[model samples]
Target: MTYLEKWFDFNRRQKEIESLLEETIAQQSEQSLTLKEFYLLYYLDLAQEKSLRQIDLPDKLHLSPSAVSRMVARLEAKKLWST
Candidate 1:
């Protein structure tokens, strides 16, 4: 396959995977968190210190601090866990 074809295929597969993950999260989690929230949890899980700060999340997830704060707020609103 050519470069263009490869890029298109990769994008297609990424979208499909994203869709499947959304579906799985909806089915599995009672809280029904967004993909960003899941990534935040996963990143926190990987941290050696296990101490998550709002400032640290932006660097870990490549999101703005405000965006990370919003995700944390959403999760807290659901009462999923403390920040």
Candidate 2:
């Protein structure tokens, strides 16, 4: 094969390995998240973490605060969070 062709193959392989490594890490990350946690983290930006308030969550989710509280409590009980 030509030198150019060999170089192309090496570059392509490096890209493939990089892509595979990225994909594996992404999946590991995704596996660590949950649907409810997505909502919590969404609210938690880079600014701060707040106690999952009872009022706003219902309005935000279109579900009752009682329901949201129960779900949040379950998550807390499961050791999903600290504060």
Candidate 3:
């Protein structure tokens, strides 16, 4: 195969792998979450390596502190997160 052909093949396989992974995520139970829930979880994940406090999460997300608190409260009520 030519170099261009090999590059195309590699990119195609990478796309396929990415598709499969995305499909898996789409089929997950967690996918039931709303957009707000999804973004909240995503933010928490980004903060995972650091000392992320529940209070600071809202500022980082640029959401109102009360809004963030309410979100965390709801998630806690659902047992998805802990205080």
Which candidate gets the maximum TM-score versus the true structure? Answer: 1
Pairs of residues clashing in candidate 3: none
The lowest-lDDT stretch of 10 consecutive residues in candidate 2 is 30-39
lDDT of 3 by residue, 33-83 (tens): 545666677777777573358777776667888888888888887787775
Per-model lDDT = 0.83, 0.64, 0.73
- Global CA lDDT computed for model 1: 0.83
Instruction: Name the better of 1 and 2 by lDDT.
Output: 1
lDDT of 1 by residue, 1-83 (tens): 99999999999999999889988988999878777788888877777887677788898778998888888888888886585
Best by lDDT: 1
Once superposed on the true structure, which residue ranges of model 2 sit more than 4 Å away at CA? 1-34, 46-52
**Candidate numbers, best lDDT first, in rank order:** 1, 3, 2
Native-to-model Cα distance after best TM-score fit, residue 24 in candidate 2, in Å: 12
* Model 1 CA deviation exceeding 4 Å by range: none
lDDT of 2 at 55: 63
Backbone clash total for model 1 is 0
Clash count (model 2, backbone only) = 0
TM-score, one value per model: 0.81, 0.44, 0.51
lDDT tens readout by residue for model 2, 1-83: 99999999999999897667656655866344444445554565433455555566677655677777776777677676555
